[model samples]
Target: AQSVTQPDIHITVSEGASLELRCNYSYGATPYLFWYVQSPGQGLQLLLKYFSGDTLVQGIKGFEAEFKRSQSSFNLRKPSVHWSDAAEYFCAVKLVRGSTLGRLYFGRGTQLTVWP
Candidate 1:
């Protein structure tokens, strides 16, 4: 069985502080991993993805993540936090969908709070 877990339910950081959101997954083998962000009223937006090749993948909005196969973890990070960055972040895994677009299995999500 493949599952995603975001241990931290909520995290608060200063406007210019560094931020790190933890994510862990349980899968039989190396799986497709992703990180998504959801604002108050907006739909989920892809922050980054790790399909193959480089383990350290760059994403939009000055965000980045590293996929560690040994520990089955894909954690998200940002050098500095911003007031507008406050949102609910989710870690998800893509599952094969048999000839169709793969389905996404998301974690409970970690809510980010940035204080100015």
Candidate 2:
């Protein structure tokens, strides 16, 4: 069916190191995909999204994602990760049932730990 998968449960990185979080989705149609980050004891923050055109989408907090339709993936990337970037990252996709109303289906998040 339609779902999102984050293969890595947790990842550790050094401060100023590059980071990449894998995201995969299965959908029949052109999917509305999003990446979000949640800091500890805080609400989720929208990172980036992909609907159509220009596979590469820029997002806040120096984050970006490339949507690969051929591979059915939207992998998140950061050139360099800061210690403050330590948080839980989630991959999500919108699904519409019946009418135009849509709901989000999220993948199990990837926890990033940044060490000095």
Report, for every candidate in turn, its global Cα lDDT versus the true structure: 0.92, 0.92
Worst 10-residue lDDT window for candidate 2 reads 94-103
lDDT per residue as tens, model 2, 1-116: 66789999999999999999999988887678899999999999999988778999999999999998888899999999999999999999886634468988999999999999
Which tens-of-lDDT digit does each residue in 1-116 have in candidate 1?
66899999999999999999999999787778899999999999999999888999999999999999999999999999989999999999886633458778899999999999
Query: What lDDT is reached at residue 69 by model 1?
Result: 90
| Residue-level error in angstroms, candidate 2, position 87 | 0.2
Query: Runs in model 1 with CA error above 4 Å?
Result: 97-101
Q: How many clashes does each candidate structure show, in the order listed?
A: 0, 0
